[model samples]
Target: MRNIYLIISREYLERVRKKSFIIVTLLMPILMIAMMVAPSLMMLYSKSEQKQVVVIDRSGVVADNLYESAEATFIREDGMSKSEACNIYNEESGIFGILYIGEVVDARDSVQLITNSSSSMLLEESISSQIEAIVEREKLKEYNIENLDEILAKIETNIELATFVNNGATEDDGEMESTSTGVSYILGIVLGMLLYMIIILYGQMVLTSVVEEKASRVIDVMVTSCTPFQLMMGKIIGIAAVALTQIAIWALLVLSASKFVMPMLFTPDIASTSGALLDGALGTVTDTGYIATLFAYLALFILGGFLLYASLYAASGSAVDSIQDSQQYNTVIMLPIILSMIIMMTVFNDPNSPIAFWCSMIPFTSPIVMIARIPFGIPTWEIVTSLVILYLTFIAMTYLAAKIFRVGIFMHGKRTSWRELWLWLKE
Candidate 1:
């Protein structure tokens, strides 16, 4: 126990003192904050320069109704052939494009828009809608409807649906307000991605540290003072401390930026333009209880998931002499993580589905899949069961990995195989 404590202290201090660790810990939060803010900033600064488009209307019915906006200016052409217009108009002369409206036999296929480059879909849609409105008005006039615009306005409907959750109780007021479906899906995806990245990033760091020590024969010198299992545990726990520290710093940075910086940067106009993206990203801060629960689950799963995979990674490092040789074995560890990420889409679509439930229950995938489900609200029993299974699996895998690590550390000048690993484990 004393030897393990020494090892843990050494490993933890060695990594946290490194330049790379400090750089990554500070840089990551800045990058995350930038990702959240940059889009809104771009939208705030974005100016839509008005485009000049020439309109040649053969039908003469739609021209009077075609209006201009800040995005585009409409220039009507009379007695100009398409060939003549194309020959004279230069993109350098500030003519964005030309819209040639032929006889409207079918509005969908008859309208042709020619541009110097590819036309904007938004511009095309706007033009098409205006023409359609004109046609509708003409048809209504033919029917002798005196108040066509007023009747159309009266018929238009914009419905806003309010969402609520019903808490099953005998009380009169059982319904509580719930988040939108989009908000829920976004939360799940973001949390799932966070889990996946942390595990992969720090887990790979553990694997690399083991490989470096083995390649340098540092393990041989260290083993004189401690057992293989003690060394492995020490390394895993120490690196976990580093991960937690980095995470905490990132959390503080994000909180500070969202609370102080974002307000100064995001005006009402910018927030309106960004719509729900900025809202959803910052919404978690308002719900302190939810945030607490989220971090709790994150902490639990990250520790279990990291320890489980870190053990295998340490064993993989011990079995091999070089980083190049670790590839074949690394695939074995990575495949399950990849599968979990792919299946996360299913969780987003239906969190209560059997696939999501089983995936969350499975130790290999539970770290990611379970975190994905937690944001929307998961049962207490399920969270407990998943955590229990994950930690138990970690313990078992650590023991198995230790068996391999004990023998593999002394191996040299030979390639390892599954048969050899099995022999090591059994012994």
Candidate 2:
């Protein structure tokens, strides 16, 4: 236990104190903040530079509501033909764009947008959609029905129902709970990306570390002092602690950045209409108490998940003599993770469905699947059961990894097969 602790401490400090660690830990938040803010700022700037399009309405019907719905000026040239409208549109200099509406509206199903600037794609699409909406509304009005606003409002209904056994209501009403859910969603995505990054990054680090030790003949001396079992265990645990410490620092940086950065990127209108996208990204926020509980569970999940996989990765690193050899073995460990991420991507919508339930229960996939579902409020029993299964699986995986590590680390200039692995496991 003391040796493991020493190993863990050494590994953690060695990694966290590195220049690469400091640079990445600091730069990730700044990059993420920039990514979040840049798009919104671009959109706002584009909105300010609104283009003035001239709509040359040759259709008497579409001209009926062209002025009411469009940001562009409507020129109703009823007497003029398509050729005349085209002539006028081509000659216009100050016009930002020209929309030529044809007379045979059924034949000319297309809306031609002639724009000089390439940056007006969004504005052009908006104008086209508005024209379509106006034309539809005018056609409806021709049938002697009024209350278009009410009809449109009804069409735009997006009510989400929360399912329950009894009279239980949705927990989204509370600001903190809503905030926490938002937080959970963000954290869930972050967790997935973090898991992917850590697994690949640290897994490669372990492989290179092993190769370096082997190349320097350091492993031979180290194996003489400690059993291969102890050596491998120490290495795996040590590297895992390093990963955890790095992730912890990143979490802190992300939290601090979010406090300032979220408000700047997400407007109140976007937050409200988009329904707490940033909040969901961050994860559940049930006051300070629930936040504490949620974060505690989250930390545990991350630690357990990381350690479980890291052991396999370490074992994989030890199994092969060369980096190229490790790639084939690494796939056996990585395929499940990739599949789990796919499940997580699709699990957000109807997370409590049968697919989600089973996927989250499976130890190989649960960590990602369960985290994705947490924002939508997973059952307590499901979480508990999944954690238990994961813990058990972790024990089994680590034990198998330790066995493989014990044998593989000592063997050199040799390739291993499943039969050999099985024999080693039995031994």
Which number leads on TM-score?
Answer: 1
Per-residue lDDT of 280 in model 1? 43
Compared with the true structure, what per-residue lDDT tens digits does model 2 show for residues 56-97? 666666666655333355545566555655566553565565
Most lDDT-accurate candidate? 1
Cα TM-score per model: 0.85, 0.78
Question: Least accurate stretch of 10 residues (summed lDDT) in model 2?
Answer: 279-288
User: Residues 1-427, candidate 1, lDDT per residue (tens digit)?
Assistant: 9988888788789888999989988897777666545544554576667788888888888777889975678998857877777776667767988888887724665677778876766677888788788887887799888787899889978655544445563335643433445555655777688789888888888788888888899999999999988888888888888777777787776667666676667656655555444444344433445555676777788888888888898899889988889999999999999999998988988898999999999999999999989877779899999999999999999999999998988887688998999999999
Tell me the spans in candidate 2 whose CA falls farther than 4 Å from its real position: 31-48, 68-94, 104-110, 117-125, 140-187, 257-295
- lDDT of candidate 2 at residue 217, scale 0 to 100: 69
Looking at model 2, residue 186 earns an lDDT score of: 52
